[model samples]
Target chain A: MNYLFDLNAFLPGVIAGVAGLIALLIDSYKNDHDGIYGLTVVSLIAALGLSIIDMFGPVGEAWSGMITYGGVSAFGNTVVLLGALFCVLISREYLKAIEHEFGEVYAMVLIATSGMLALASANNLIMIFVGLETMSICLYVLAGLIKEHKIGAEAALKYFLLGAFSTGFLLYGMALLYGATGSLSIPEIAQNASSNLLFIAGAGLLLVGFFFKVSAVPFHMWTPDVYQGTPTTLTAYMATASKSATFVALILIVSKMLPAETAEWSEVLEVIAIITMILGNIIALVQDNIKRMLAYSSIAHAGYLLVGLAAGTPEGYSAVLFYLLAYTIMNVGAFGIVAYYERQQGLDFTDVNNYAGLGFKRPIMGVMLSIFLFSLAGIPPLVGFFGKYLVFAAAINADMIALAVIGVLASAASVYYYLRPMVYMYFREPHKDVPFVQAGITFKGTLIVLTILTIYFGVAFGGLHDLLASYYSGDWVTHLTGN
Target chain B: MISIDWYLALSAILFCIGIVGVLIRKNAIVIFMCVELMLNAVNLSLVSFSSHYGNVDGQILVFFSLAIAAAEAVVGLAIIIAIFRNNFSVDITQINLLRW
Candidate 1:
């Protein structure tokens, strides 16, 4: 509550806000659009630089309670910054194609990234809700930003309604927990494990709210529609950055408050994981549109992450983090290629049939997408395989044999759908009229970097895991859960 | 004088009403109203707890939540306007863009 100025804690947000305001001004002028875009990108890079410094460099311990910067928060921040960069990398081309380019888009994205940074470091419930709303409000507008498209409008509205509903649930749960325990701080709630009926009710409702936020089954009905309706670039942003942040918040909640008492929640979560995996993979099999297919694929991946979570161990938690990191690379690359083609084709959905003979026409885009698909299917020596492997291994180690078995079956079933587009792309006759468009330099450069990272992580798992293990060994629960 | 249990029971009933509204109402706006109701129910309980513990932290939180709820409502309405333009109706049942 002190009004003392520490420029460090407030600097990133201020920079992002100023950059966003400048972008809005430039867009209003309707000139120097490229300059505006450049400014936005530079702002995000600056923020990314600060986050890395906070992670690796020694920031004074003054703001530890407000915004801690140890290994786990640093890891989450690094992934989120990567997402922002990917958005910035794709912005010049994607925004240019829509012909209504504005700097506000990039600015808002960076600001949201900052909010997520705070959310990850939130030591209390109040900061968490503030962070959640700041992030969500920007996204609602971003989702519906394409004014000309009815689909965009529909997606935005649906997302807003459902997101607000979930927020309500989340807030109510927080309040009830406060009521039951007479505390609102997460550390306080975690330690005071009163088994009163009110406490149990609050916990139960809070689980539902978190499940909705992560888009777990029984509460995930909104994901596919929203994903399909939003712009492809925005969809990629949601699939990677937003999902990563939410899961980080979710894992913190579960581990900090419900570790020893996991038996109360694990039973319900196990059922959710099983249904989410099966339904997501099965529905994806019938999708002809590549984006929609990826939407379902992301859902199935969520279920796989849940399998790690259900195990409730450090190995399980780190395994989820590793998998999310891998998913970010593969999914972003996949969507990047789609965004590339949409620009060239003068605005068209990337359907599976359209990709037939694409391998011959646009070898680079086609091959990159194939790698992403294979990885998603959990093929060996790909990033996706290791992500799923870690989660499954964690599951077995936790002795959740049946859940691990079902997870494997779900991944196997996923192969059929993930590979379907590859079949159309590589094996079938080429579609002659729609030649693959030459990607702009920025787009191509980003794709190459993403592809390399995807493969490198897939192959060199031991080192990355070891580094992550050493860096991320401290458990928030031991301190929070003990009275 | 109303006992603490009375306040708790009243909050529970309000929460249940919100749940029923979400399950039964087809109008997106109405469903949103129900969500607000649920949040209020939680706030009522929080206020009661603040009194019980003789601390104002929980009460201060209720204010913060109220601000957030107001913002959420504004955004929700804006989105509904966009959707109403797209579908020409506010009925959730009619907005099924995802059909197998």
Candidate 2:
């Protein structure tokens, strides 16, 4: 509980910022591609390394009850940094293709990632809003970075406008909660939970805003359009990093701030989760675009994550963390292939038909994408199934039997659409000769790491479960109750 | 001449109007105005709650929220301008390129 400026608390942002500066400087210089990419990789690696150290090392102290730090905060940041690294790797060919490429995409991502890190560790409501905006504003621009393209500009507009609307709701919700509880610190809010109409309305509005961010049903109209319209690499970043940050924030609210009123929030979340899962998977079945399919699937996966959230236990939170980790790997890997195909075909053939006979045309990339899709569909002995298993079990443990049933049905419904690309690659005949683009060393390195992690988590589930259990062992609630 | 409950009720009605406007209106500028309305509703409640609690934190939050509302207005309008330049219309329905 020492109160000197903990370098560990700020080191990740510093690293990301400094790395971003280096990339920016390189862009201003000789415009050498290798140097820019090389510097970016090095800085990201350094930041990744430092972030990992802070996570496993001693790093947090209670900041006047506004914030506390420990393993859980570090774990979330580590996930975000890993996401940033993969995003940088995937952006190589994606940015190069649209002729609107700039080194600044890397900088924007790193800066936004720093914002995410800040958010994960936020203990104060003000800190939460600041971090949320920081993460979101960068993504808003990144979504439309292709300023010259019609779709890209439109996507950016939609994201920004809707994002602002949701933020308004979120802020108002926070205000009502503050009025009811007379506190803005999460711990203090939990300490003052009331069942008044104002409190209920506030919490309800707050969750509606979060559901929009997580692309849950009824608020998910923005997902497909944004995903399909934005550059593939940025879509992957949004699908992963934005989703992770929001889920972590949701976990904080439910686990720390809403315990006294769990029944109310749980009921609301149950309905949202059921609708999200069904609507997401059912709509995905009809998608012809690979990117759009993944977008809907991402929504479905958000539903699965919500199942864990509704459980209202430490086990549920940990399961969500694990599932998000698994989802990141599979989803980003699928989009990695999309980026690759865009480079090879000189067009983003998100259409399923364009993937016909890609299995033979580019066997390795095709196979990897197939693996990602299968894992996403919850194929057994893959990472995604494990993610589903942990979450569903947590729901059942909490006696949310009906929710667990809905989750299983959605996973089954998901299989048909997820396997469509694989069917195209393996079963259909080639219509034309599509040139295969060579993945640079960086892209290959990322794919290899993600694939390994996906397989490892799928097979070594017990080890991960034990690790997560220990990581989440702290009794924050007891601390709140002064027990 | 109004009771606290009446003021709160008025604020709630104004807030609902704003939320409906945001959800149903497609004109970018009008939607922006609705967002402003929602913020003002919260401000109304915050002021009343401040007097009720006899505390100043709620008022301080009101000031802070006003600042944030201003910031949001600036950013939202800037984005609207960009969208207009690209699409030549403020009708949000034309922004359908990014919707499902």
Candidate 3:
């Protein structure tokens, strides 16, 4: 192991951390909290630029293989930063509307991004736990930022309780794995994978933690309440950026670090994926609240991504990557629209009937949201269709035909609930005579860009897919751990 | 010297107690304490394994877990306090503004 620190390898995380502190410093003096927003966005863009640049550069392990930041990690970092960027852009209107423009929100988000970068780049189980905790702690605070709002505080409390409990599971799993394999480095653990019952139980327990983070079935009870109770902008970040980071960590571990254990675990994951898909979509059908409905749909989407993980192949890895990109774009856009049209700031504007005549009132917002929902439902000519296609295709290619069939049916069932809001928007009469808020340029611009990307990526994602499919120099499987 | 099995078995027992407490305890603060217990149980196992194998890595992990667990407790208590400010109680059942 080298004694020197690889400063360049850790630059992205450094940028976010320093920027978060700087924002907090600026927030202290600026009584009104206006300056911090600009500072936060600038830092996020800078981090995004660094991540993209790193993607094109050379790749290798850093800090004695504690971290690796090239290839998929680079791509994941860029996606997370971009998600943060969009959330920040949409949040300005929300905080202003609610008169809750606390500058600490931006600082907290930057810290969260820093944590995410650490998580995506982790090579050891200990590193993964630390990164996960840092990010989770920040999000617990962000969920209840509106301190006076009971719903926000409750969301924070519930999320904290569930999150801490899961962390306990995660830690115990790590302990068992360490006892069985005698190491915390994932590659070392992989190298020592045996059919011993201890090893299998340790791996199973480890997955229990990741599943909770991804909000898979049997571990997703807190998602709806947290999503509905938290402010919409924060909910957008939690649903998209947070979810993507975990998927990246999960894919890296399951596919790269622990492929030897695939046979034992993939079947188990397949069964779990089937259950998560069926439960998520079926429950969503009855939800009247927009945030809660999207929360359930997000669980189904996690199931689809898990299908790729259960395949345990390089193609499965790439498919999960592409799916996360599509999921981030569409999910963030959907939540952004919800944040945009919310009538009351603290209260969730969730009745299905509230969307009535929305298409006629604001065609741009309605059409944009419709396209996002369509993309989510696996409708073609949208990136979300390709997201589902690549995953189920990978599952089929891996000879899990039963899992593929279940995925298709669950997605088909999902389309019904996805279109319910559109039906109310274009066909029915609104129940409330609510006054309209003027649409601003930034709001329209964010929607138009997301809509364009959804279609553009749908047709043009093959190149990106191939890029993700290409195994890289820094990949733990390819060259690291003295393998 | 105590055998490692004793430590592992004790850790497992304590871990189960923590899980059951979290499931049954209604007060948020007590639930937080249960989470701490679970974490400490893991720490005990980690420390036992580290000593048995003569490996410092497991000991280092125990240290990190201890620190992070403290940080988590801080955040959890803060959130619980925030909720208490609103409703004067931290009973999990009392905080259901956005239930299914």
Q: Candidate 1: where are CA atoms >4 Å away?
A: A1-18, A21-32, A57-64, A346-348, A471-483
lDDT of 3 by residue, A279-301 (tens): 99999999998899999999999
| Candidates ranked by DockQ | 3, 1, 2
**Which rank order by lDDT, best down to worst?**
3, 2, 1
lDDT of 2 by residue, A1-483 (tens): 654555546667667767767777777776766777777777777877876776666645555554445566766777777887798887876688657677777767876887787777777776677678777877877887775667877777788778877887887787788778877788787778878877888888888888989999999988898898778988999999878877877887787788644346887888899999999999999988888889999999999999999987778889998898898888888898888887665444777888888888888888788788889989978899999999999999999999999999989989999888889889999787756657887777788778888888899889767766676565645654552
Q: List per-prediction Cα lDDT, in the order shown.
A: 0.78, 0.80, 0.87
Q: Write the per-residue lDDT of candidate 1 for residues A290-325, one digit (tens) a residue.
A: 888888899999999999888877788889888888
Task: List DockQ for all candidates.
Answer: 0.60, 0.47, 0.85
Better of 2 and 3 by TM-score: 3
Clashing pairs in 1: none
State which candidate has the highest TM-score: 3
Model 3, B1-100: lDDT tens digits are: 8799999999999999999999999999999999999999999999998888889888998888889888888888888899999999989899878777
**10 residues in a row with least lDDT, candidate 3 chain A:** A472-481
Best by DockQ: 3
Q: What are the per-model C-alpha RMSD values against the true structure?
A: 2.7, 3.0, 2.3
TM-score of 2: 0.91
CAPRI-style docking class of model 2 based on DockQ: acceptable
Residue A434 of model 2 has an lDDT of: 55
Candidate 1 vs candidate 2: which has greater lDDT? 2
Clashes of each: 0, 0, 0
